[model samples]
Target: MHKYVKAERERQAQRYRARPHYEQRVNFSVGDYVLRSRVDEKLHANKLRVMWVGPYRVVGSADYYFTVEHLINGRTMDVHPSRLKMYADDSLNVTEELIDHIASQGTLLAVEAIVEYRMNSDMRAYEVKVKWLGLETVEDSWEPLKTMSEDVPQLLLQYATTTSDDVFRRAVTTAIDSKQSQRSTRR
Candidate 1:
């Protein structure tokens, strides 16, 4: 009778596993970047809210659970696999046209401040706040340094010069006119 009971328990467990979506867990690992799904149990109004809110780093993991560290606040959390999704770096897309445009342009953007930079993290980039040649204060934003360095090395070189000496000087009208000539030649 005990043997029969053990066999029956195994059969039940097998049946449970056979069900669709059963025992299926989100696959994630420590050090992976993930966005936590926003789940509000309070009300159904959560549907109108933002779906995901992170590029949080997965710090640790168990069988079907993970620990994530917030990129912004450096907060940590142990979360179920269902709460997380892989963070694809969908931020920057440097087009050939954009690269040519950047390469041709001689306008120099000023680094007003290094507002908040997270050092040598996952992406290996610094988020810098910049004030461009002819932009408003409200237009300043956090941009990845690596993207700038790769796409517009000349701009980086120019920025490097201004940054080291701590002088924010404009490149005068000749540079602007030359840029205009370059733009006109492209057309």
Candidate 2:
């Protein structure tokens, strides 16, 4: 009896051990939205100070890896499948034009626009206005302000506000023109 019990126990253990561990694969595509997990580490004070802070959009993807855009600091990052959860929607399909308009506008336009403009420019100053949905409307009329510089090109002076000389202007203009020419040629 004792021998039979021991053998049964061993058999059970072997069966349990033989079972394969299952891991789910999360596949994300470009433009599909996802969230990024944040890290919190007191031990590494200089490393991370927050935890799980995003419902970011998925910008790119590899086999099992995904790139998510974290909106907290306007950064896009890569994450593994284990760190994501699906976004839930509880509503049925309603084909209202107003609903479509609202959805297209999104909830975080002001924040994203500001971040994008700041990241893309090094010197140009911008004034931004954020209006709440239905509370205010945007007017569509404006002439862009132009700055005058006799010795320097206006575009160069826009970048190097402190410098005012033909040499600086020529160098900056040449660099910009070369870049534009290259881009045109590529197209």
Candidate 3:
């Protein structure tokens, strides 16, 4: 039994040595933009959050990893090649104006859909519950119908039409019509 086990181990070692080894190569060059992988705790406990951020500029390289600098923050870190993916950009240059613009921008939440509507405590206006992109149902927010009408007029119109409430429907229609009129006058 000892002899058989020894022979089997030798055969397994030989088979392992017979297979070819492949090494991961860094495909991106220095000065190229790459996104770094990260976990965010606030956004659905990172379950539905955007795991990769930045268009970090690759500033230096080592034998096994690359150094990256955040364009907006100017912070630097070393990251493995496997932890990064190329960020496609039409222009190769990372201008100071571009970085400043991006840095100056405030956090904007993207709306996935207008899920439901409700009346404000005053009972004079409607508020639509907004489902945000990359967020859970529990995080849906209630926004004023007048505020959302300008941003998502078509969605509000659709939601209002489907509901049986006549007052809410008329209010949505009025809000949308006013927004359209404002745009036309500006044009």
lDDT of each candidate versus the true structure: 0.58, 0.46, 0.80
> In model 3, how large is the Cα lDDT of residue 176?
94
Off by over 4 Å in 1: 1-20, 40-50, 89-187
Clash list (residue pairs), candidate 1: none
Worst 10 residues of 3 by lDDT: 100-109
Ranking of predictions according to TM-score: 3, 1, 2
Report how far off residue 89 is in candidate 2 (Å).
Answer: 7.8
Encode model 3's per-residue lDDT on 1-187: one tens digit a residue. Answer: 9999999999998887777644445687788888887656656564555567777888888988999987764668899887898985435677777666544433245788888988888867889999976556886889999999998888889888899999899999999999999999999
- The candidate scoring highest on lDDT is 3
lDDT of 1 by residue, 1-187 (tens): 9999999999999999999878665766666777787655543665655356656678888875888875533557788887777874434343567434433333234444433333346765454465543455676766776544444446544555555333221221233345657769999
Over 4 Å off in model 3, which ranges? 1-106
Mind sharing the TM-score for model 1? 0.34
lDDT rank order:
3, 1, 2
Candidate maximizing TM-score:
3
